[model samples]
Target: MALVHLKNAGITDPTKIDESKTKAVRLASEKVGKDLYRQIYDITFIEKNGPRIEVITSSEASAQECSMSGVDVFVVSRRLGGP
Candidate 1:
């Protein structure tokens, strides 16, 4: 048996960045972390399965899980148009 049994996974085509991205990795990580939390609550994505399954998990909880496993999960997000 294998971990992360991904199958038929797909992602949208890459798009060009139209806005300036932040250079701070920490800020990007923070934004990504929050966005992931939103995605979990919003169920933004569905995993491909006989019966489609909504992907839901807490970003904080995931971080803790990774820590316990001696791994790290970084949710980095780059953005545009900011003060």
Candidate 2:
């Protein structure tokens, strides 16, 4: 399984996430379940300025989940790290 990092630009509001994303992840899990690992959220700092929220998932489907949420995604890259 490959780790996917999804970065997006939007206001840091927890309540504004699309419900379809949550559903997508749930449905995707039923198919490619075990491959999907953990998910982490962070904020990126550009030029010592404000932060942009990022969601790092463990698979392409997971990245799609974030995209389905209607957030303006910037990048989705594979994660390189130890388990």
Candidate 3:
């Protein structure tokens, strides 16, 4: 996503910095990057403190949302994995 970040920042009419490296003011006004490695913590949290809770992601839950309404609620976030 470094490329995405740079592409976003380069659009802001950069003077000193490379235009291709920065995004526009509107797009670059705020930046949020994910570390993409939080599934371990999420799974651990659920396993250590289970509340009959089945932590799942959007993609996972999407396949079973309607069927899982009575059981699991899809709270999609940065992390989700394990049994």
Best by lDDT: 2
> Which whole-number lDDT from 0 to 100 does residue 73 have in model 1?
28
Per TM-score, the best of the predicted structures is 2
Q: For model 3, what is the alpha-carbon lDDT of residue 79?
A: 43
Worst ten in a row by lDDT for model 2? 1-10
Q: Where is model 1 more than 4 Å wrong at Cα?
A: 1-49, 61-65, 68-83
| Model 2 TM-score, all chains together | 0.20
Give lDDT tens digits, candidate 3, residues 1-83.
22223235442111223333322121111112232111111111122222222223211112223222222223334444754
Cα TM-score of candidate 1: 0.18
User: If ranked by lDDT, best first, what sequence of candidates would result?
Assistant: 2, 1, 3
Q: How high is the lDDT of residue 9 in model 3? A: 48
Q: 56 in model 1: Cα distance from truth in Å? A: 2.1
lDDT of 1: 0.25
Estimate, for each residue in 11-80, the C-alpha lDDT of model 1 and write its tens digit: 2111221113312222222224632321122122222322222232333224434322221222223334
Determine the backbone clash count of candidate 1: 0
The best-first sequence of candidates by TM-score reads 2, 1, 3
**Window of ten residues with lowest summed lDDT in model 1:** 1-10
- Candidate 2: stretches off by over 4 Å: 1-32, 48-83
